[model samples]
Target: MPAEKINNSNQAVAHSFAFVACVTCAVSTAHAQSSVNLYGEIDAGLAYFSNIGGHASYQATSGLVDGSFWGLQGTEDLGNGNKAIFRLESGFSTTTGESLDDHPHYVGLANDSFGTLTLGHQYDLIHDYFAPFTLTGGAGGTAFAHPFDNDNANNTYLASNSVKYVSPTLSGFSAAALYAFSNDAGQFANNRLYNFAANYQNGPFTAGAAYLHANGRGNTAGGAFEPVLLPGANRDVFNASVAKQNTYATGASYVIGDLTLAAAWSRSTFSGVTDADSGAVEPSAGFSNYEVSGVYQLMPSLVLAAMYTYTKGSSAHWHQGGVQADYVFSKRADVYLEAVYQSASSGAPAIINSADPSSSRNQLLIGTGLRAHF
Candidate 1:
């Protein structure tokens, strides 16, 4: 996903990756060009769930298992191994035809030897480097999203008003860093963000590691992040604002013939947490996640993938599992059937990402849909 590779997302995800895996699996290159191209994906489907606001429900879903977006990408050949690049992407919901968030739009300059530098909305290290190794980052996608995407393995948020740098690969290694400004007067530390990550790939194996820190995460109007951690089901009780947040992760994957295996671990903490309802402050909230997954290309057009995740919280825990079968119609189209399940510690309602919490401690989801890109 170098600036030189206009078609590459720098390992961006499938369905956000199955592009989940490939999207985050490789930072391989594709030749840059001097023309603009229109690209995006549409994923729509029907889903059945055991609990949503305490009721079994069925509904139409969009981007339920993958990202849905459209955008323009262009690069100009600047000669002497130099290039100018730009991208503008927006996410949307196929169900309601409503707007979602914008992707990491950016403008940058690149050189074959010097790497790339860009400024604008962007992704941080958790998503760029470590996510690829998690089920949520690859083939499992939405169905596999870790509880509330606490580690960002599901890319639940973005770094806004930022500057980023990506280095050229050296001996199978490449690295990236990002810094987001608070953009608020007299509040430089409020919602400011910074992160770094590195990845390596050789033969059938790949590994990555990353770290991120945020000051005054959701405590102001600066917009580095929106303070979306789910310490509990009660949003008012678990305020989106935090004084500080730190997270780190590592993961690896290996391929063998038509099969792939992967594992990942992540830890996150939110300090000076507060209850918006009570104006009560707590010491901190923390989370740890462990996951393993596998994918098999049973045929050229049909593939299967599965994953399991265990998450430990300061006072609760959850276990999740999911599987998907995708059948390709062409290079630009596919259909899939998937299912996901979760069981939470006693007294804690089971909740899947993007869905309401279960009335009890268990929940399940089943879905089928079509996804296409151009």
Candidate 2:
């Protein structure tokens, strides 16, 4: 063969090899930019309740300070400041291996400049924004949640068949909204919800406000609250003929040195209640909760916190107090002791964590637990 022909053939092969190398490099770079993470927390403890249906009991509990759960979350860079994100989280009873369902399971798209949009079962705006200041929110856990979790600051209910939007934080301000579809053909208002929230945070101060409205409680599978999300018999809290429900909440927290002080208020109303076997019989019943809480860093690794909540309803009232001592063993684990005391009047039963209602008007609970995050 001619030398010139050989040279031409070699050039053709070299060009093809170069193209393959460039393609492989591009694919590798894109793969490296995407990330998937498995993260979760587990909290287990032994608790003693001075009164549960008038009987004191000792039991092993899970998720005292934080719910025991695992999750898979991931993001893929789509370039141009846009990305795709998804999360699937589940809760479980650490002692009995019972799986808790109706958690957040969503996939969405996000952008640095635009925002985020997600679909599936997800949290309402109140849980995202205003709950942080409350004890039952991410800060204090279940032991400090409001009575019956009526305000939903502790995420007692999750919205299904929903769409959520979250705006990027601007100057320490962020906002979010959620809408859940009832999926009841021809019954548009049967168990639908609309929620919105906003938050602002600065050096030492943070504030949040949120609103939520649900139509036709107990009329759908899981619009706002349902028995599936709770233990047996605990469904009595919302098991009634309620035409509508609304909640408004606001809170503010200030940090000074190692101490943080916070206050929150919420008003919840159930309208058009019927003469059912459970729930209020009035046309409308309302509940208002006032809370004041504080967290102090006793040392670098030890912390002390307390909260006092006064709740008043149309027919009853309650006073609740909570205190906790936490010791950090490391960044991923900790141990804590917490207690809650409650007193109710006007024939209202003292209920803790939606467990059995106390036969009397007073109830007390103490628990010690270990928590780890990964």
Candidate 3:
């Protein structure tokens, strides 16, 4: 145990400690390369509905134009041009402080060159591709959806237990598709959906088309929509379990200077609709909607927009119009004012977003709101 022996032992121990520290630092750096982000929006507003039960009423509203929700999104770099990604979003009412039953949650794998594949509760191709050109899908928000949201352009329902694929853009063109399982052990078709879409964007012009088919519309155990749970008045409009629902849509948009113009068309058909109570098949029905919208930038912080839609059925027709003004307080916050009017030539009551039906065949609604994003 001489001094030289002690010094040699100390140097060996120092080397071992240095090695451990280097390894720890390397591991921490690798972990830090992967990142997660939290983002969301909360929109609240005041709304006035005219002709609701023959009386005008005012109430606090949430997500009138855009849904209010909070979400977490993450991406992990797996190296070799691949990554893992995920998102979870929840919707809530600002007035009642209640949760919205339908929201989007998803996890996925992506490749910079190959494409992206995701699974969970999510929107189909219609909502992603063609809906963007429609007022509801664009900036018009929740209240701008077509009658009944029959075409799902406003994301009225999310396809659960779903698998989706989105291809990378090629020469300004991209495509996406999705399929949802019924999740019923013995009934593969009990509640299933499949959809596909393609889009193209070149400079200031954009266009897209989508198609969707679903079976067992009201089978809660396997389906996303519970038509029977709708309000009594609007319930009958979709109460029956539709054996099959087919929807098709196409949309186009163009930007000229400070003005943007858009147009869209959608058709929906239901076959073998059955009474939820009696389980009796009812007659088939269908509807078609045509819409046009325009948005103009009054200034860098102010914008104005207008939209009109015409819906037609075998015996029903509706004419709807909307106008909106928005002013930006900041990049993450804004205030908006909107007015909507609808005229119907049908015995069915006029309803918007599950609110009470108009006492007559015509209805008008006005709203002012604020939205913040983070």
| lDDT (Cα, tens digit) per residue for candidate 3, span 188-283 | 888788899999999999999999988886775656455542212266455777778899999999999999999999998888778887887777
RMSD of each: 13.2, 3.6, 2.8
Q: How accurate is candidate 1 locally (lDDT)?
A: 0.84
Question: What would the TM-score be for candidate 2 when compared with the true structure?
Answer: 0.90
lDDT of each: 0.84, 0.84, 0.84
How does each model score on TM-score? 0.88, 0.90, 0.92
List where candidate 1 sits over 4 angstroms from the true fold. Answer: 1-33, 230-237
lDDT of 1 by residue, 126-192 (tens): 9889988987788767768888778887877878888999999999999999999999888888889
Q: Clashes in model 2: which pairs?
A: none
